[model samples]
Target: MARITKGILGGFSGKVGTIVGANWRGKDIIRSIPNPSNKPPSEKQMLQQMKFKLVVSFLRPLGSIQKKYFGLNSGSKSRINLAVSYTINEAVQIVADVPELIYNKILITKGDLTGFQDVAATPQAGNKIGLTWEDNTVQGNAAGTDRVTIVCYCRELGSFAVFEAAAERSALAAEVTLPTIYTGREMQVWAYLNTKEKNVACNSSYLGALTMI
Candidate 1:
């Protein structure tokens, strides 16, 4: 790859013969398009591709939250990119050549803001979830007005139930009733605290899976 500086075409995009021109991080660059390869992928390459696929599938749906809270963006890498990388490296497990997500290791949000303390989730009647946490409003970077967010993923339904601003940090507890479709299904729950304005957030806590009553 080579940066284009005052070229005749002035940083043109799209294909120009064998090389492709494009803008990256406010700079224009050109790189040769790789020749099509007929060779098969190696085992290691396949494994890596599988892991990447699994992580992308799970995280893409949560792109809005991840982009805002996953991590600080670096240069060309955005927060969503960082989330994908982290999930692939730290949250995926392989069994018999199949990549599976370790729910406990998954992070719905990651940031420096103070997180929940001793958070717990319990299944309640009528397919509701009762969430409780210790009062940590005075803890590091925490505030009584910080709002709580909940995320519940149902693998059986291949869907998620997200509740944003369900409560405030000082409230210490909240309840969310799942949709009728989620009745009798097991869900993996997570919770996090964010500023009332939703501009900042803390790392999310995985509150364990529970079967809806």
Candidate 2:
């Protein structure tokens, strides 16, 4: 059995063998490990396991925030799993189809700094991801809001596409093509307004997922 240990989260955080995170209450914790019944998992089973593990590892750093957000009802990692699955759901290529989500007020920066005024994304025709956003330089202390950083996390491939919005355009709509392997799978997109002077980033906005058709 793997032993749990404390991490930098001011609480116990450890990973052993197939399990990750610390023991809490009577449970071992989230990033639930998979149990393969056979000696060697089938190709399809392997894919599913890979995806699950990827999601868990990716969300590892957000453990503390998730715990706080879930409070007393997290329930054996069910909340986190459901939340992740919901966010991972969505499809590919076409013009920006999502309703615009505007950031009108200053959101309390979560990680380090704040971000753009608004951001939205949806798949465009031809397996392309379309991103749109409004500049917030005038609304807040955006004296350093020089660029926009967008990231697309491929849930199937466990990879990312990091693209920078053109600095010259304030209300910019940018496009990025999905890899051939991504067809029929979903991706989570994230956005941030970045400045040249910070170590951390503007609180990242989860822009939803888009699956390639």
Q: Pick the candidate with the highest TM-score.
A: 1
lDDT at residue 198 of model 1 (Cα atoms): 78
Worst 10 residues of 1 by lDDT: 1-10
**Tens digit per residue, CA lDDT, model 2, 1-213:** 444355444334555566666656665465657776658778656555555554456555445434333223445555355434532332111224322112222121234344655678888767777777765556554644455666666655756666654442255666677777777778777766655554344555777777876
RMSD of each: 2.8, 11.5
> What's the residue-level lDDT of 134 in candidate 1?
90
lDDT of each: 0.90, 0.54
Candidate 2: give the clashing pairs.
91-211, 92-211, 93-124, 94-123, 94-124, 94-125
Report the C-alpha lDDT of model 1 over 164-204, residue by residue, as the tens digit.
Answer: 89999999999999998988999999998888877889989
Per-model TM values vs. the true structure:
0.93, 0.46
How well does candidate 2 score on lDDT at residue 30? Answer: 52
After superposing candidate 1 on the true structure, give the runs of residues whose Cα lies further than 4 Å from its correct spot.
1-9
User: Best-fitting candidate, measured by lDDT?
Assistant: 1
Residue 167 of model 1, lDDT score = 92
